[model samples]
Target: MAWVYLIVAGVLEIGWAVGLKLSHGLSLAKPVHTGLTVAAMAASVILLGLAARSLPIGTAYAIWVGIGAAGTAIAGMYLFDEPATVARIAAIGVIVAGVAALKLVS
Candidate 1:
């Protein structure tokens, strides 16, 4: 399904986002880390393009970005200990709800 691909693409977007943090610039980036980051970035864009074929560009892009932001925020909290404040969690919840709403409306 188009939604499935979109979801996968969004997850991969999270991958690259976190990957960028871990990569720590080209100077410190390891071969494996850089490779995986590049691979995830490429795959995510490819899948996003595929999903756009069936969905409105604005809606698809919003959903993709929403999912990526939510996933990355949560991941950063757990993996990087960024922050786990209640307000931050609530914001993530709202983003998730918005993503769901867009999916339903579309």
Candidate 2:
């Protein structure tokens, strides 16, 4: 149950991130992006709240943010043709490692 919420949170994080990009600084895609972003954030808050029952704040948050960053970066590169430099990949790796460490320590 908690894991489910966390997973939903992760997906919502992705949704909001993609929405932000499509928003084009909230100029053209204002309504669509704003609506999606707001919904995603609201979903995320509910998810984190549910996950708090079983997961530590530090651990859950690190995992959520790390997965969101890695997933979004990959999606941006493949779906949107954003840069996929070696350094960027390495940075994602580092973020994943940090998330893993958080889990391991707990």
Query: Which candidate ranks first by lDDT, i.e. highest?
Result: 1
Per-residue CA lDDT of model 1 for 4-103, tens digit only, reads 9999999999999998888874334477777788899999999999999999998999999999999999999999989899999999999999999998
Model 2 stretches astray by more than 4 angstroms: 27-29
The residue pairs in collision within model 2 are none
lDDT of 1: 0.92
- Model 2, residue 42: displacement in angstroms? 0.8
lDDT of 2 by residue, 1-106 (tens): 7777887897788878887888775555488888778788789878988887799987788788877888899889988999999999999899879877876786
Give the TM-score (vs. native) of candidate 1. Answer: 0.95
